[model samples]
Structure formats: C-alpha cells, structure tokens
Target: MRECDPRIVLGLHRSRYERRILTSALDLGVDAIDTSFNYHGFSAHTALATAGSDLLPRFKISTKVGFFPTAGQAEHSLDPDRLREAVERSIRDLGRAPDLVFLHNPERSLTGSSAAAQDRLGMACAAVERAAAEGLCGGWGISSWDPRPLPRLVDGTLPRPDAVMVRAGLLAGIDVLEASEALAARWDLNPSQLWGMSPFGGSATQPLWGKLDPRVFIQSPHDGLSAVQATFRVAYWLPRVGRISVGTDSPTHLGELVDALRYEANLDNLSTYRRLLCEQRDRQPL
Candidate 1:
C-alpha cells in the first residue's frame, strides 16, 4: 500500500490518514511488514515503534537497505555509506532491532552478467555483514529475481545468510515448484519459510487503491493478483513453504491480498495444486 500510492507515502509521512489505515490493515491479519530504511524519512519506523504498543506482537517487520531518498531515489547505487546510514537510522527510527534486514538490490542493468551481478551481490553482502556486526538486525540476507544463480553466487564464499527472499510467481523466471524444492535442498532451508516477494509482476493495469479484486488482474497475466493464486496453491501443497511475503507498488493489491487470504483458509487442496504445478512445469520452455 505504501508503494502504490504517493498519497499513502504522504499520508504516512505528512498526515494522519495512514494511522487509521495502517491500524485497519494490521488488524486484517497481516503477519509482517517488509518496510525500507528510506521509507517516509523515518516516519514508518517511528509509527511502527509508537504503534508497537498496539501492533508489535502481531506483525514482524523486515526492513531493507541500499535504496536512498525513500520515494524518488529508489534505484540509486548501493554503497557502504548509504548502507550504514540506513542501518543506523532504521534502528533508531524503529526504536528496536528489526527482525530481519534485507540487503535490497533494485534491478540494475548490470545483473545479467555474472561478474557485474556478483560485484553487486558482494556489495550487498558486505552491507549485511556490517549491519549484523552492529546488532541492528536479527539476520541479513538477499532478495533475488532468479535463484538459479544464487547458490553459486552465495553458497560458499560469504557467511551463509539466515534467509533469502526471492520472486517465484508464475510470471517470474524460475519454475515455482522446482525453485521452492531446490532452494530447500541446496540451502537446507524450509521452502515454506522463504520470502516470496511480488508474486505478481509490476504491470500497469493492477489497481493501486480501493477494494482489491482479482478480476482486475485479467489484463496483466503477470500481475500479483494472478500470481498470488499460484503462490497460494504451491504453498498449500508444499506445506513447509513459509510465509508468503508480498509487496506492491499499488494499494489495491493490498486489498487483493486481503481478499485472497479470506478464502485461502483450506490447506487440504493438495491434489489440485499438484496438478497446477505439473501444468506449469510442462509449459516451461526448454
């Protein structure tokens, strides 16, 4: 919701609208918040801390690093200074150590090549190490679009991360089912626990506000509304799959998340979900 609306950013940072909205959203059973070091110039951290009396035990917060200027300067370069600044400010703003601090890397033009990606990945790793040493977070990790290269990139050289967040929706690169299983096997991770961000892609048609309706996603095949079902289905079958951490550049998507969770109560739909997984696997290009 914060990403989707400039108003949301404004409301959270400059006005009182967010307090009521946030309280309501938190009441809706969201177990966590993946906030940023740069969001709303520390107000997010402040609100979370102040609201802790009301919301802390209910929702875990996972903040990010590497971005700057919060709203407009998201794609800026990742540097040690920016990284350290974010960590210190976040700990101060939130008034507590974050449960997790993700070493965020916005999609850079350099990610396609092995050397550039590793260099970029290395910077993130160093930032995490710095934050961890300072006791700003419980653990540090990376978020990736593709996990195919992750094992090679992160497996042996640096300290093993406690967690990894990645994109695994139908619109994403990896085979969702296989990716979940492989990550668990290779990393000795619980597939259920991996953070699944942007189950939908950043397509324009997805609404940013109002009651979220999945039907609105019909135009964009890769929208989060479309992918969340796949995410839910996969998790239903892969019960060990941990929390489905979702984010959006739109508030309507937040509403969609609420709608999805409303009906996703049953965990016994394994047979149908397995069929869906097999269908996706068969359709992947060689």
Candidate 2:
C-alpha cells in the first residue's frame, strides 16, 4: 500500500460505490472519501458499510447532510431537529461517525431576504456544530456549490464551520471563486480549511475539454501529462484550495490523479487568468 496522501479525495457524489474502487483508493494513497447522506439514492452510507466496512476505518470520511427524503423525493431542509437527526442517522448507517460532515449547500434552502437567510443559515450551522461537539461526527463544515450569498451572512453571530468546500477548476467562474474566497476570509479560514469539489464541472469527458488546451495553466507544459490531469492540477490554484475532491472508479484513473500532483502550477499564469476573469466579469451586464 502507498503512503496516504490527503490532497486528493475520492468523492462519492457520482460514484458507483464499488469495493474495488475503495481498495484501489487505499492502494493509491487516496484514502480520503467524500460522500453524502443523500447520495446513491440515500443509500450511500449503507452501501459503503456493505462494500467496505473493513476499509472505511482506513479512510478519512467526509459527508454531507441537509437533504432529506420526502414522499420518495429528495427535499432540502435546514430544520435543526431534522438536521441533527440526519447526523445521528449518518453515524448509524456508516457504522462510524464521519471525520467531517458538511451542511451540503445550505444556500439551497436560503431564500427570502438577507436577514432571513442569515437566520436560517446561522441556525443550521449551529445544529451541525452541536453534532460535531457531541461526537456524532469529528467536525462540521459548509459545502456550497454556489457560495455567492454566504459571505454576507457570515457575521459574529453565525456558528463558524470547521471547513468549507466549493466548486473548483478552470470552469469555476469569477463570481464563484471570489465568493468562495470572501466566505473563507469572513470565517478566517486558511487554505487547508478550504476544500474544493466538482473539479471537472461534473465530468472530464465533456466536449469543452477537447477544445481548450489545459497545458497552458501548467508550469511545465511538455511533461506528457494528459489534459484532464492538467485541468485537475490547475484546479488547486483556481481558488487556492488545499484539498480537491474528485470521483473516479478506476484505479488507473485514480493513480493518474495522484501523479498529477507532482507537477507545479504556474502561479503567474493563474494570477493573470484570474485577473482576466475579473475583468471580463466587470464588463458583463449585472
């Protein structure tokens, strides 16, 4: 088995939850797995326990809550009682408390005025925070697909999350990158406290990946790394996140992701790219 590397997380958001993938992850040093209460049709935790209860302890597990089953449909909720119950249920299903659990897009249920949103968000965070404190999980966090409204709601009164996960990659727009940064700053989070997800905008096989040469973002453009690997590596600098959650069932594919980390990102090009993104955003109609 390879030494564990925490940087590359095996995200189960779009996973098959196969036993082979879990074993492959352990072999490749990608020991951290990110999943959710509602994944695989709300059976993710049980599936994980069934597939690799023995391997679960070997991996650092992170998961999400906030979506519940309603009449056989998934519904978003921030009700503290419901959220608290979910955390407990997650522990039961996984057969172990998760190392970290996120609010799972609190922004989805955050509708109405800013103050109302703030109130909803604060209460929801507090509930998860209490769960972590109670040993229901190791820690609590916030995972936002679109973090635009979160920064403003964070103030002295809101319960602080241990970490934050946001979308990262070349596809992550200026609005998302800036908002994620702003939220991190508001919470006084270091780079390590921030995690990124959906590095390929949900899939690497998209036609857009064929159009753009991702090597432009790498410092050494001729190292024989595939463009998909280059795009994954560049994701770390897109918003300066320390850990990125990527999903792949193939061990070969997982090894490719781990190997991509060896290449250094061209910070100068990334800086220039961010500047261009901001400039273009500024020119757009609000």
Candidate 3:
C-alpha cells in the first residue's frame, strides 16, 4: 500500500466552516484529510463532495466506518452488513472512494471477552478488505483508541493493517502516549504508516494544555515558537510519527500550524521538553 503524505493531515471533525477549513488546508498543501461517517452529521463528507471532482484528486482522503451518529444517541456497530452499508454510504457521500477507511474506535464495539473482540475485529477487517477489493477504498486500518490489541494486529496474529491511527501527542497526560511510541518501534510498520491523531493532545474544543500542570511547561522559551507550536513540534519531529492530524476551523490557527510545521524545534529545548514529559509520566500512578 502507498503511504500518506508524511507532513500533516487535516482532521475534519464536527465544526463550523467545514468546507472552508478543508479547502484552506488543501490550499496550504496538507497531504491528507481525515474524517468519519459520523462527523458533523455526515456533512463533513458532503462538504468534500461539494468541493467538486477536480480538488478531490489533489489530496489523499481517509474516513472511518462502524460508528453512526443520530439525534439522540450515537450508534456503534461493526456488523459486516452494517459495515458494508457504511462503506457504500461513505463512497456516495464523498462522491468518490476514500484512499483509506478505518474501523472507527473498534475497541468500543467489543462485547466482553478478548476472544469476542478479536472475532468482531476479524469480521470488520474482512468487510474492509472486500471494500478495497471492490475499489470502494484503496486500503483500510484501525483508528484505535486502545493500543493493547495493536501488537496482535501488526504481528499478523490478527488482520494486517495498512495504517494505524492512535491518539498521540507530546503531553504525558494523554492515554496511550507511551504505548503509541513503543508500538511504533516494535511493529513491522514504517513511520509513514503510523498516523498520529490529536497531535495537540486533544480535540480543538478540549486542548491538552487546558488542564496541564504548570510544572510541565517548558522552563526555557523556545525561540519564536508559541506553546502550541512547541507542543506540535514534539510530535512532528518524532522519527516514528508520519502524519499528525490537526482539526481547526480558524484559518489563522491553521496557518499557524502550517508555519509551525516548517520550523524545526531546537534540539536542546526539545530534549528538555521530553524530559519534563517523562518526569510527569513517572509521577503518574499505574
């Protein structure tokens, strides 16, 4: 399978100005766009569809399946029939096949036992493969919230993944932070095949630094870099992190991120920031 552009991925979550954000990101040379069937009542995919065919070919498109959004409560199911229907709906909604389709938070769909989860995952994988074979998608993967099952997936104990998306960032407070790094090294996968979600530590609404401990802040200022830039830099500079997904409706915020991607963090400052994160992680209760 071909790798996504290594620089940045524009995350299209539920937000205002969804179309504008996507267009601006493409204009700024974002390598890919990430969205799911449930984002913004499925308007996220519709926005891209409305962008016309010409613009669609410019960037790689990725969307997730298995989760359905509704008025009262969100729905989660990985039934093969449901998955097939989702894939078809996604293709129709986007007006084109996605470059990649992920099993959106498959962990949540688990019944009870590990064996049950594995069986469900296997069925989902088969469904995804059928989509790929039918040209509805070029490839498929797991947008995993949990990392425990990844080693099995990557090692061929489960279905092979074309890519792996996980919540990863510089902040120690985020779940799966260390596990993501460890998995990247241990898995038989290229950095380009590893997609880092929430490089800013969380969604745009709830940022990682919102409740961060003051001591975790960089004691020394990183020259010409904002705290946000510094934080993004840590994930961007990691050798094993291929694509970092950032979602924003503000063009100015998007521009700042684009600029930040160009500025390499000073190695000394980066080292200190990493050390602080490690210390914070050590202090956490197991």
What TM-score would you give candidate 3 relative to the actual structure? Answer: 0.81
| Clash pairs detected, candidate 3 | none
Worst 10 residues of 2 by lDDT: 214-223
Instruction: Give the CA lDDT, 0 to 100, for residue 171 in model 3.
Output: 44
> Could you tell which candidate, 1 or 3, scores higher by TM-score?
3
Where does candidate 2 clash, by residue pair? none
Better of 1 and 2 by TM-score: 2
The residue-by-residue lDDT of candidate 2 on 41-137, one tens digit each, is 9999999999999999989999999999999999999999999999999999999999999999999999999999999998999999999998899
TM-score of each: 0.61, 0.98, 0.81
- Pairs with backbone N, CA or C atoms under 3 Å apart (clashes), candidate 1: 4-249, 4-250, 191-241, 192-240, 192-241, 192-242, 193-242, 200-224, 208-252
Q: lDDT of all the models against the reference?
A: 0.55, 0.92, 0.71
Number of colliding residue pairs in each model: 9, 0, 0
**Residue by residue across 1-286, what tens digits does model 3's lDDT show?**
1233357887877456345666677667775888898887766677667754567777788999978766766899988998889999988888889999998888777757767777777888889978888898999987877765544433345556688788766642333655666666555668788887777656533554555532233334435656576566566544346777777778778777776665554556556666777787789899
Q: How far is candidate 2 from the true structure (C-alpha RMSD, Å)?
A: 1.0
lDDT of 1 at 238: 39
lDDT of 3 at 232: 67
